[model samples]
Structures are given as structure tokens and as C-alpha cells.
Target: MSAARRRGSPAAGLCPAAIDRVRIRCPQDVRRAAEALHAIAMDHGMRAAPAHNIADKHTPVDAEGNNLAREVFGWSDRKAWCGNSRIALDSPITAACRFESEPFWVNAQGFRTSLPNHYLAAIDLANFEARAMTRAAIVVPVHLPFGQIGAVSFNPLDPALTELDDLFALQGDAFGVYARTFVASYEHVMGSLQALTAAARLSKREVECLRWAAIGKTDVEIGMILNRSRATVRFHVYNASVKLNAVNRSQTVFKAAQLGYISLAS
Candidate 1:
């Protein structure tokens, strides 16, 4: 769906005007724009390319991680032009990365807030601490219905490049447009998987349990507070977890918070 153009993006940091002037474009329009981003990055002595992802909170990684149109810039591979990451499926996978334990889910940047903004991942950086990859990385999170959250990854293949979200955010809107069109065209490929969110109607008990979980309450605590048995609380949590397609409590909490089922900070 074409979202109505907004006048501003959240907290436009360094290049507010540039981001505001940015517009959306399809694969055709991107032919020129992608070149411009690459050229601009190179002019600054950097390399960069665009990546697109679909909005399915099911996995944090882009099911189609890389955007080949980006090859025009300088990237070497297109296998990722359409790839997937397990982020949504398991972002801070229990053992893959050493993420500090937080009671609930976090945005891409690892913040416990659901404010309308985007997130970036450091892992996408080319070679941080001896990692063999590109130099710079930019990530943008797009929220869609049914708990679908997709994003774009722009990583300049330069092995010496270094920048933060601010640099790439300059083309925030442009990248946003490019990603939208890419997904729209590729939506057919993504197909209609089952919705991974709350049911058509969440039960009052489910809301109560979710609200309690938002506050970091365990089943025992919630049961005590609601005058029910721990098993009852467990039942509610299990039901909600299944509905969100979450395998564990933390994931359920995170997905629920992501969907506004509960306030992350509250």
C-alpha cells in the first residue's frame, strides 16, 4: 500500500532537509537514484549499495536481504540480492550473538521503545573487529500490519569506510521509496504466509497477561496479581505466544510489544 507522503521523518538529525526532499521510486526510477547514492558515497571516498526487505516481524533478517540493483554501485555479490536473515526468526538468537539480557524485545537498534523511527544493526558493518565484510552500514525498519517489520540495508563495500545511521539517513525517504517499490513488486514472491500477530479478537485474559508481561511479570507473579493459578497465566501466555508465532516467552513479549499489544517501556 502507498502510504501518504509525510512531511517529516522522526528526529531528522544531521541532514533534515535532505531527508525531507527525498522521494520514493520504483526499480526503474532507482536505476538513476541508486547510482547517485553510490556516487555520492564514492565522492566522499566511500562505497555504498541499497538492500530491501519485507515487513514480516517473523524474522529480523531480510528474507530478501540484498538488492541487486545495488550492484550498479559496487557490491560484488547478488546471491543476497534476494536472501533472508534469521533476525525476525531469531534476532538475538540465544547463542549466536552476546546480547545483554533485557526483559523484552527491542527495536533493530536494541532500544526498548516503539516510537515511530528506524533502527540499524552493527553486525551489518563490513569488518568490525576482524570481521570480513564491508565498511559502512545503514538500516531502516519499516512497520507493516500483522506484525510484519521489514527494512533496507545499505552497506558500502569499502573495507575502510565508517559512518553511522545519520549519514545514510540523509537519503531516508529515497531509500524508503525504493524499498516500498521493491517489496510491492516482490510481494508476489513473498506470498501470503499466515498472519503472525494477535487474533481477530484478543481475549481480555490475553490482554491482561500481555500487559502484565510488559511489566516483566512472570506467570507466577501475574497469577498472584490476578487471583488465578500460575497454570492459568501460563495458558494465556501460551495462547498469545502461539498466535504471535513466537517460540518462547521473550519472543512473545517482544512481538507483542512490537505490535503495540503492550507498551514496551511501561
Candidate 2:
């Protein structure tokens, strides 16, 4: 069957031709998958960063200790991009990823997306190139389980090309599909920790309680809002905590936010 006909099948988002190239069943598959993605990106005048956890300071490497950033994209100084420092905290690209799940592009002016996000507009872009270290880029944000956000940036190999509006229009969707597939498969095979418990599913009531709790509603307040007794509200929250393997009410709410059951945004 054609790739489109195989939608929703195993490794659905990946192209049929790339399915075998990018499947990550072992450690070595990570590098193989990354190379497959790199070849596609280079065709569009871009370089790829296969996987990056926005919250992490260390650059992602293959299980064989190959720095994908350095080897794939030729970024020599890993520290300048990411390290035991606050670069992620200070990066506007990282800030944009927190609020956006779709693909977007950035330049010295600011972030550009299909939809207008006030949150992205609010970020400071005074030193855009200095912070992001690229004249411009098309970034795909991959929000994962446990609230982990990964990103793949396609930067123009040409230094003078600071705008990507036309290129984004032409190949953005293709890049989004490929980027998400590579990052998600890489994380599935290479991630060190299990991101969720088997019974982490929350019911509608549990989700409602956590959503209210995330906004700082006390149990009594949430009970009043939901028209349930205070004791009932407490029970649901506690049940959610048990399901999520969280220690306390706060962690329970946080985990729910991570799992996308609750939104932490104001």
C-alpha cells in the first residue's frame, strides 16, 4: 500500500520509503534514522537537529556517543548551543515551543506561525540571532508524554537567508511530518526513563478536578464549582494521584498538566 493508505498503521506519519530507514528498534537505529532525516532536510537547503528536549541542557547523542548536532549539522561547540547553562531558559525558540505544538519559523523580528499566539508575541527578541545562533529557522515542536517537549529545527545552510516565509510555505508540512517521526521514534528507542505509568489514564472527573486545581482552586472551591462535596473532590484528586504514581496533590496536578489533562497556561 502507498504511505497515505497506511495512515494510522505502525509508524504512520513516516513516508513509506523512509519507514524502513527510520524505524528505531535498537541503539544503532537512532543514528540510521537521523541520517535518513538529514538527507531529506538537506534537499530543502536545511540542516536537522533530530531530537532536543527543550528542558534539557545536554545535546542529544546516539547510543554510540555520536553528537548528532555536531555530526549531522556540523555544530562544533555543543556548549554554545546547549550545556550545563541557562541557554534553554534564555532562548526565544525554546520559549515559543512551550506554547506552540505546530511548526513555526523565527527570524530577528519574532516567531511566525499559522495562528497568532499572544504568548509568542510577548517574548523578547532583542538578541534573536545571538540567542538562537541562526539567522532563521523552521522549528517543529514535539510535545511528549510527561510534559517533555522536543524540537527539530531546520535551518538554512546559506548564511544570508534570514527569511523562511517562502520555504516554509513550500515544505513546512513535509518537514513537520518527518521531524516529528524522527524525534518520536528516537525518544521511544533511546530515552532512558519510562515516561508514564501503565494506569496513567485519568477519567473526565479526575481531569476536571486537576484543571481547576492547576489554576489554584482549593478543594473546597473546586467542590463548589463542580457542585460536588469537598470530600468527593479530594477523593478524585487522590485517585488521579494514585493512577499517576504521584506523591502529593501538587505533583498530581503537575503530572496531569504534563500529560495534557490540564493546561498550566493562564
Task: Give per-residue CA lDDT, model 1, range 119-183, as digits (tens).
Answer: 22333422232231323344344444544444445554554445343444344444445444443
User: lDDT tens digits, residues 1-266, model 2?
Assistant: 00111123443333667755756777877777778888888878888764558777766678878887787666667434643267678878888899899888889877778677778888888888878777889999998876788998888899899878777766666677777777777777778766466766899999999999998999999999999999999999999988887899999988888777888889
Give residue 115's error in model 2 in angstroms.
Answer: 3.3
TM-score quality measure for candidate 2: 0.77
TM-score of each: 0.46, 0.77
Supply candidate 1's per-residue lDDT for 187: 40
User: Cα lDDT of all candidates, in order?
Assistant: 0.46, 0.78
Which residue segments of model 1 deviate by more than 4 Å? 1-50, 53-74, 78-172, 184-192, 195-199
Candidate 2 lDDT at 170 equals 62
What is the Cα-based lDDT of residue 92 in candidate 2? Answer: 83
Model 2: lDDT of residue 227: 100
